[model samples]
Target chain A: MGKIALKRTSLYASGASPVNLLQARFYNEDCLVYDLEDSVPVQEKDAARLLVYNLVKYQRPVGKYVIIRVNGIYSEYIDEDLEAAVRACPDAIRIPKVEHAYEVQKIAKRISEIEKAAGIEEGSIELWCNIESYLGVLNAREIAESDPRVVALALGAEDFTASMKAARTKASLEIFYARNAILMACRAAGVEAIDAVFSDINDVEGLKEDVKLTRNLGFDGKTVVHPRQVDVVNAAFTPSKKEINYALRVLAAVEEGKRQHKGAVTLGGDMIDKPMELRAQTTLAQARAAGINV
Target chain B: MALNIKQTAVAGTMESSDVMVTVKPAEGQGLVIHLQSNVLTTFGDQIRATVQEVFSDFGIRDAEVFLVDKGAIDCVIRARVQAAICRASGEGFNWKGEDK
Candidate 1:
């Protein structure tokens, strides 16, 4: 309530297929989403669920966002997915390829009811919408603003590429429109826009560029696929020291303005009012969330 | 045998024959850890590795550690492990600065 930090966004990372060994590694990532959806295969679903559940149960990391992306809506095991996720009570459940507001409403409603029945804290498990298809891209705004519990939006690159009949390249040039669309939708709806994962694990430089693009485009965070990707993603998403120094100056000016009974102030000769104050506060929030002291 | 992780409050007593020290958090912004030691020295790198490995799963950054031996059984190990977690979690805030 002190200050709202919009930059404190959550990220989801996709684990490799063979989960057990690497899962612990991926779950340890700095991103908020430890995606279980695309990473876990149909066969290892149960084991993955158990592993996630145990980890969450015994050790709840303080202030870290850890949501599980359950299997897709069409997966035969959505019910099981819900059961496992509901039992675990992660910060949220990410639904892939959400085509309409109704999809979000339905999942939100179901999770709400389950939380009621299970006696899990109401609103403990929120919803995350993934815009993966043409329909989903069209409905992105509605999906982002649909449910109060739906706090984040994600781009599903592979499915979206296939749906658009675009080339799947290392640079991800084809999905530019969709990416911007999703980001706009998220910003409009007052939620976080998460960039899609870089599927090609070998393209570290390409991944870095993609991360930069998304960050520049106002993405809150990007989903990662490998442990190697985690460090870079974490680094890129974090507020730079220069930004933090600016934020500190902004906060200082705001404080001084408050003492002087002025509604606004200036920092480094730049106006520091509501919007600027909000942005600086958000920057600080993000830095703090990422363990950056500034 | 079920692996055991245990610790005593800074004010409490811990006498270890086997001790494993796991700093779940290394420096800044510390966090939770599960430490186990048998005959203290026996814990060696494996105990250190296990604790480090477990801490990674939780993404813990900064933490402190200590272990004691009484030639504990597996169950004792589990109890001590819980205690270690509790202490690290700041449950023993009152015992901060007391001798082990």
Candidate 2:
């Protein structure tokens, strides 16, 4: 669970579409999720799996994290999905509708077996668990800590609201609790928390506001359905110039304090402690990941 | 290898960056490929060579392969052909064994 690079936006491309798959890497999103779950038609499952396998194995995307979103844990397609996805060797495999820690463990076990059989380095492939239901949200912490392979827990609000039998709205008052619960769980478990997608692709303003809310709520990133939303999300997640400058000052003050053999670290007459230093480091890390000079 | 073409099967779409491949049993005829691509003048030979290589990899000597290419790359072409042949043969793909 060490620090990883910033993943501000994860874009979804239909697994069955060859055109989309080929063009996914050129986009600005930090992560590209080739979806094989809800996006592919039932009859086209085999076709989509083969296409994704070939795309990941032969024409793998460079300079971006690649993940394959498989079917639900209970679905019959999960086995075949894991088999092909593991062999394809993407950065991670995202499992949808995960409700329990055992589901994560079960899939991790299966992935381990596949990796062993395929001669792939064991524990190389990671997993991202999607929390789509009330149970999943309640058990988010356990799911996040279920296995070492579980790196992030993403909130799937569309399905969560459906599961709660509630209406979905633009303000997103309904999913507020679930969002916070997931964020806290990810923080407690020392894993990344991803927010749900903003479904209204046409409303750029609304999308920007939503990204603002996601960043304010301490989410690591947001799931984006379209390529156009990538820059919006990445911009919202990146640390601002003012914040980066303050972080640089904080780190410099800490270094100066160390050199002076001082007992306390201070910048601008305010006390700087461990948490503040860590936050400053994280801000600088995010800025660096965003390709800033700092 | 050792794929038996039991029936006609098709894979892929006619969209851009994709190729629609239809494989049919041509017992006596040896590997007949009818390819129509938008980039036929420039990439026709390369595309045909890719198909031929896939056929050789699958150890198929007799089949009528019909492909309508929309400027698909080599990987897409290879995937569509393998999918079509696997569907035609009514068998699961031995991905590890058929490492290309």
Candidate 3:
């Protein structure tokens, strides 16, 4: 058995009306994320911030993680959003539309300043970057690897498609390279890679397809706009029984081979080498974190 | 009757069955509500939680509430509770109230 850290899959739901409070309650039970940028209109942004700050004062749910998705680093609202995040002390701050590692450093520096000003410990906050543009995709690896505070990198499909002037069709071939690149970067950096939201709330089948593709691409999880999408994303990201069984088998075989003085072993008629063993270990760890028995 | 519809005060929409209200305190009085609905089990708690959130401006104890609902979204719950409170308190409500 290996130690695993499970980052809760939170639905970034933010709109006026105790959206922050609703998120607070939900996150108390499950992972819930609040977005103060795109989800809120300009006029309501400050109000949203205020509500979020106030809500964070209350006791949060046990084992539920809270993340505030702030505006883009380049946006004028980023400063205010940062101030709010510092005041609220959410588990993580998601900086949307990040293009470069410098942006992460910039936000981290600002967070440090705020922590200093607020008498909070420096580097206590975590950062999550949203790779929503061509430049962001190109720099995804560097960005994820730049700051230790970067817990994950998210791929924003809608914004990415818009930025690339490409259509989001059933196949989504246009964004294939970007998705793979982000996943690779996350893996290289040993952080989570989150997939973008499915825009068509009504198109359940389409959303399912997208989830399947991204999960197959090694995305840790998907961001969901609607509550109905949560169950599907969770199911897609969770390891199947077959995978869990294989992981269990692999571990058992490795243990046995080690006992027999064999350097390698075979499972499912394939040789289980060091890489396969490492993968099996990781799979088992992930399954356990997701509450699936291997 | 299985349910009762009481209008504390009306501002935006009351013509159709979709009632709307904004709960506010009057100069010398407060809002009280007594509602019973066949909406569903524990609907009272849901409505009460929402009313408290939407009208946090008013004193919770000073406000008395009663609601009969036929399954409503959070929006409708807030609207109806506010309308009832406004009607009971005799205070004018701004239909475009700030979101919770």
Candidate 4:
């Protein structure tokens, strides 16, 4: 995964809902995660699998990262889920409730076999792990470092809070440790960290603040349920005009310093060093990715 | 093997998010399709094309497909029809190794 643009909003559409899936492809979500795990009924899994496979094959998700959230490794349907997901040939596979490195390894092994047998270019499909449990948060680093195919680690708040016997709130003070742990592990492992979904669709203001918190907490983006929340997440991740201007100034200062043969320069009474310049460059990159004319 | 719908069967939901497909044995020759859709005028041709492709893939010579579509695309429509047909004809779904 060499420098793929991160989706500011990854909207999940039920793979079983053909109507929704079709409609979702037209939406402006940067990433559309077609879910086959919790959304599809146990009985409909087989049929839904085929439906997702065909949809991915036929539908060209232009300018969107198409990811299929396959069933958990422990589930009986995981084999079938991986088979359909790989054959569908989505851009990525999001493994739910990944608690151990072995889970990532297992999925990688299956993806490799399927890619070869199906004649897909090897390593073309990426992997995303979901840190949804206490164990998952604890072993997030190992799971993230499990394979090169793992590009992003998403936090599943509903399951994590349930596992910890804590209530999930709009303020989200409960899953603080879980979020931080995953974020730190991802940063250490050099993978993207995505925040969890905000379930209350009616509470727009609450969602706004939640997106702000995720962005403030260093998450790259959020996992959203409805299409309406896409823009909110996108705006939250995109660099503001003021921020972009400041970043530009910092880079200018760095260039000036290099021209003068000075070791460094200061901005806002703080040293504008390598790390700060890198952060500024990243902000500009993010602005570019979000289509903001920085 | 020329397969025919043995009974009337429905798969999927009529909800706004899903598509409902109903299949039954055809009383007359050829395929009869009565498509009820919200985007009937705009997407009618596409819907008919999708249903035709599914029927051709399954080798069904005669069947009546009554689709109450809630804006389902080709993929969901294909799955619902396949499931409904499998149920109507009393056959198992071997949905593996069919990917091209």
Best by TM-score: 2
Query: Measured against the native two-chain assembly using Cα atoms, what DockQ does each of the candidate structures obtain, in the order listed?
Result: 0.02, 0.58, 0.05, 0.43
Q: Write the per-residue lDDT of candidate 2 for residues A1-294, one digit (tens) a residue.
A: 233476899999998899999888898999999999999998888888888998898888777888999988888888888889999999999999999999999999999998888888899999999999999999999999999999899999999999999999999999999999999999999989999999999999999999999998889999999989999999999999999999999999999999999999888899999989999998898899889999
Cα lDDT of model 3 by residue, A1-294, tens digit:
111256535676663345334544543123567778887777656545644554553443456567788877778778877876776677888888999888899889999887777776787778889999999999999999999899899888888999999998767898899999999999999999887878788888898898888877778777877777777777776777888788889989999999999986898798998877887777787788787755
What candidate 1 gets wrong by more than 4 Å, as runs, is A1-28, A32-36, A58-63, A247-281, B1-100
lDDT of 4 by residue, A14-118 (tens): 877777777887777889898898999887886677778778877747778989998889999888788778887888999999999998998899899988888
Cα deviation at A280, candidate 2, in Å, is 2.6
Provide chain B TM-scores across all predictions. 0.39, 0.94, 0.51, 0.89
DockQ score for model 1, please?
0.02
| Model 1 Cα lDDT, one tens digit per residue, A58-132 | 444554566778887767867766766777677678898899998888888878777776777787776778889
C-alpha lDDT of all candidate models, in order:
0.64, 0.91, 0.69, 0.86
Give the lDDT of residue A148 in candidate 2. Answer: 97
Under CAPRI classification, how is model 4 graded? acceptable
Query: Which pairs in model 4 have colliding backbones?
Result: none
Q: To one decimal place, how large is model 4's interface RMSD in Å?
A: 2.5
**Candidate 1: TM-score?**
0.63
